[model samples]
Target: MSESKDFLRSIVEEDLKSGKYKEVITRFPPEPNGFPHIGHAKSICINFGIASDYNGHCNLRMDDTNPTKEETKYVEALKDAVQWLGFDWGKNVYYTSDYFQKIYNYAVELIKMGKAYVDSVDEEQMREYRGTVTEAGKRSEYANRTVEENLELFEKMKNGEFKDGEHVLRAKIDMGAANMKLRDPLLYRIRHVNHHRTGDEWSIYPMYDFAHCLSDYIEGVTHSICTLEFENNRDIYNWVLDTLGLELPRPYQHEFARLGINYTVMSKRKLLELVEEGKVSGWDDPRMPTIAGYKRRGYTKESILNFCDQIGIAKANSMVDVAQLEFCIRDDLNTKVPRVLTVLDPLKVTIVNYEGSEVIDAPYYPHDVPKEGSRDIPFSNEIYIERDDFNENPPKGYFRLTPEQPVRLRHGFIISCKEVIKDETGKVVELKVEYHADSKSGSDTSGIKVKSAIQWVSAKEAIKAEVRVYDRLYANEAPESLEDLNSSSLTVIKDALIEPAIVTEKIDERFQFERQGYFYADPIDYTDEKPVFNKIVGLKDSWGKKTAPKQESKTESKKQAKNEQVVGTEVAMSDEQQALFDKYTSELKLNAEVSNIIARDEKLSSFYADALAELNSPVGIANIVVTEVARELKEKEANELNFTAKQVSQLVKMVDDKTISSKIAKQVFEEMVKSGDNPDKIVEAKGLVQISDPSVISPIIAEVIEKNPDNVEKFKAGNNKLLGFFVGQVLKATGGKANPQVVNKLVAQALK
Candidate 1:
């Protein structure tokens, strides 16, 4: 498809083609009162994206009419965020403060032309006159003020002749118009406060309605793109331009829908509240929807742009699923991040029979990646595997390690559990396993076929890293509707043991722990020795587990068992127990056949069986099969679901694994469904694999240096700003495949 014809572009194109305007000019006029958020990013992208597509100029104009809230800090952050998103306003940067003199002159001219007048009404009285949406507002008593008197009062208001909000200048528009914005809206407000840029030069500032259109005209902006909220204001935008009688290209306003996502509050006021109330760390909090927040959280500009493209422009407002946003992140990250292993929740496993002196070389990427490079990762008698991998009494259809089952220690040897060591609290402290020396990884002679391969990090070379496991900021999909403000959903796991490779100088890189999800070094908090990593998004979808019906079923089953015992002595059931039984019986009546089918499936683990019985909804299973499984199959473009019905059914059986988040998992499943690829392979190829291993990525740093000589030279030439350039080059070289934090550290080392 051609890039020059987005919806807004098409409008501009039609306008230009029809000779409505000889040249197309646009402006991104941000109110410099607050930092730009992700919502603003969409506007920036739309405005600049359209202007660039149409070969037009876009002015970066600051709508600083509200000097009470506007600040230079916000202006700088806005500029940075726009540039970071890869758009340029060139030399057309402007401020409304720059046109204060002109705007004041225009207001005076309007008063002289009997198009404006001085109003003595207070703020409350003004609102009373500017009636409700359905009612016509009462005309101001001062509406018919003579031009000479109106102009004189307006000048007095500008010359600090009155206190703020005492007397104001209003446009002499109709008060009975259906659109309330045109009801003699204030052209200028009396504010004695010092302006951030203009200082105490004037007392009156032009209102948004009056100054915005005039500023656009002064800059010769041909098209003024704004959100749909301004649709009604379009009339006024044109009025100010037409009244000026300016022969310049008067800008036409086009409105597009503002982007909104589920579970997110996009209002700048609410976002600021989040920051001020300490709900989030700052504006750049990964949990925040701000552009800076996303950048800090390891999102790429390309991914954000791609998401905008997928959502497309719409004339009406709509809410986009947060899953789609995550999908784009995973899609971009997967293609670019490299695969590595780092255990977040660590449990020690002793290979009892293996010699303590043993160490092996593991290739950073798969053998197919470079085909020649491999780094030595120390392997010994002791290693740490995920605690969830082992089950004392193995459940039905469980394929991971158990009492007698042998499992492959990824990139190492096959090990069989011989003993489970427990601490004083009776918790399994460690696992004693015996390894087959002959069954080394990459050696087929051992002839060992295990049911599953578990990932591990050697305890001897492990790095004590802080791993932050981030969940959704809100527990509810529609958090804005909820009244409770205390429901925080973020969990930070600080004590995580990772591979020694992770402890290397490349602390800022992202690494995919094999069988785990993607993770990135927390750039703001991480250091070379004690790296802190944030779980960008998990490898799987676990949201269903928290809200799954299994808990209710367990409670119901227990209640039934207790009621039956009580009824042995007494004949009547309590109201609550009877209600529970009735509900259960009703469910059985509704889905007996599907429930029977699930009960008869011997291959399904007890966990899933209970979940199915509790859920008692065939629709749940059907959704899992169709939406989750089938969708995954389609994403992977598989000929058939080859993993197995047991494997497919087991998804519901086990509590949702925390390897990947539900958001990330849904995205991964979508990719799998479309491509017919294994989850690991899909994740590896796409950089969706979370990096938990430091050792594996430490060496990938060397490879990044070998690949980018230009960036290395730039870094050494004292152009430190080129650090991001190097990071971008590394990411580009890896196809967004390498962990960026690791790339940053490694690039720094190579340059030094």
Candidate 2:
């Protein structure tokens, strides 16, 4: 472990350096009354991360002070979740109940010291005595009780001599203190309910405030890092330690803002209500913000940790854009997860020209990644493509399949749509297509080009699977603002067909369906024959529709005039006009402000018309000119923007190789916006290159191990923590020249 000098770490470092304590210790005390959420992840990471980084020890303590709400089941689940997050509590695991006798003796000691007494004030009376922010509270009549009498009463109350809520032990602190928590807070209360761990032995329990500070002192914790809400309670925390004259360690408290996303209510109580009221499936529902939920939804722990790091500990409360979280997951999954194709909404397509009994063995990965062997996918004359891929009446900029339009069938041959096969209801049931044998993907033939390449699965070899395409649980960015009891935001698509290649032994694994986005195997519902996958998050935010300009040709205008005269009414707008209308309607939505409410609305319509009137291109205006642009000007934090719609769309385009590689595109994108320059110009000036060549990375890895002799020795000595140090030094040596994947593999081999 190394010395940490961050705000919280600095406190610990100063304490240790000044001989405040011989050794450092910390505790991650969670109340085991409910399942932990992403907010809890921050506390877990901070406590355990700091301890590990500083060579200190962290205790996984359950503050099960409230017997009525706490349970053994919750305790077990919490422990399992903490371990799953890749943290160990070591040998210092404890419960507040474990120190019941010790805490009782401390309370008796306080009573004898004239610092605490048993009070008969009921709940309502006690609340009244604990005055508001502007006023001071009056002392209770029991505040000056004799030590002999207080001790006798406290013992009897604990021995079942008093009914529940009749008597409580309270500290004799100043009622005039500005902080409400120090106004003679309750130390112990009579609870007749049976305890989960210590059954029937005692009828009283300690409150959180009383138990927490003392637990830290008893365990010799150096720092008590907690969320910002507990900032005001620091006074009472220190008072308890100071009055007792105990051998307290550093135990200095530091507050960090809790993690709050745009569309989430991080409150444990509200989350529980959502689970109980059937708004979500369970604690592990893919839509939930719980760690288990995220894990099931294909979010890697590394991604989560990176996200926490990016949204560093701050003093002020801030709402982190959910896009940042998604970005973290995408960045992590993109490198590790293998790509595959699966169609959710299928429309059958038959190649009339192609001969029968033909099969193609298409390679899976475009770039060779070690350990991920290729699979043979059967391609026949018939296949299923996305229903939305084809349109009967094509509009301008519609690049996908249409009448007489040629499109590449992913890894198969280039095909042209000849005719549409329809049912009696005028619904398109199938498409008749002709394939060019010379334009087979692997065959080197000239003059083969298409505007669109659509994904497909062979109808004969396709596997029937349940693909749960999950969207935002609420249509609104902030669903918590909805007052309706039935305003649930989740939708589930039950049936889907996927390529057989995806059904290998790693069917339980997660993969990106190329253009479709990321998905995870449903652990509960998936089977060998029928796989079920849940859409974790989309490749890009595809919530809104694209609008095209209306066409008014001379021939159509004459027919429209005749129809208008017959009904004495003007003809309604065309499909393009209606699309524009819908877009405007979307921009007008007055939903809650979580993400970019204004930009999301603007994206819904032709509001860009007004925007473009003041700018050059409507597309450019829509992308680069918005409230977010202004927000970046004011705050300089791109993450604090209300919406990331433009950034997300650009990222998708970059990945598709429209302009530059994703790595360079990201760097240029950030710089262009910050410096107010053209993206293309910035890319040229910086000469930011994406290192895809593995040959260049091999030597750099060897050099990195040679340079960091100490870290190399540590790695060989079973100090796996130093592996990251080697990676960092390798990245630095190359000036980030080496490809990370190649460097990781080469370094692992060198160490072995």
**Global lDDT of each model?**
0.69, 0.70
| Candidate 2 accuracy as lDDT | 0.70
Q: For candidate 2, write residues 443-499 as lDDT tens digits.
A: 838476576567888898888888776655443344463342223245455657788
lDDT of 1 by residue, 359-455 (tens): 6777665422322344556788888987777878865555668998888887788888899999999899999999887888778477876755677
Q: Pick the candidate with the highest lDDT.
A: 2
Q: How many backbone clashes can be found in candidate 1?
A: 55
What value does the lDDT take at residue 49 in candidate 1? 76
**Ten-residue segment with the worst summed lDDT in candidate 2?**
589-598
Task: Name the candidate that leads on TM-score.
Answer: 2
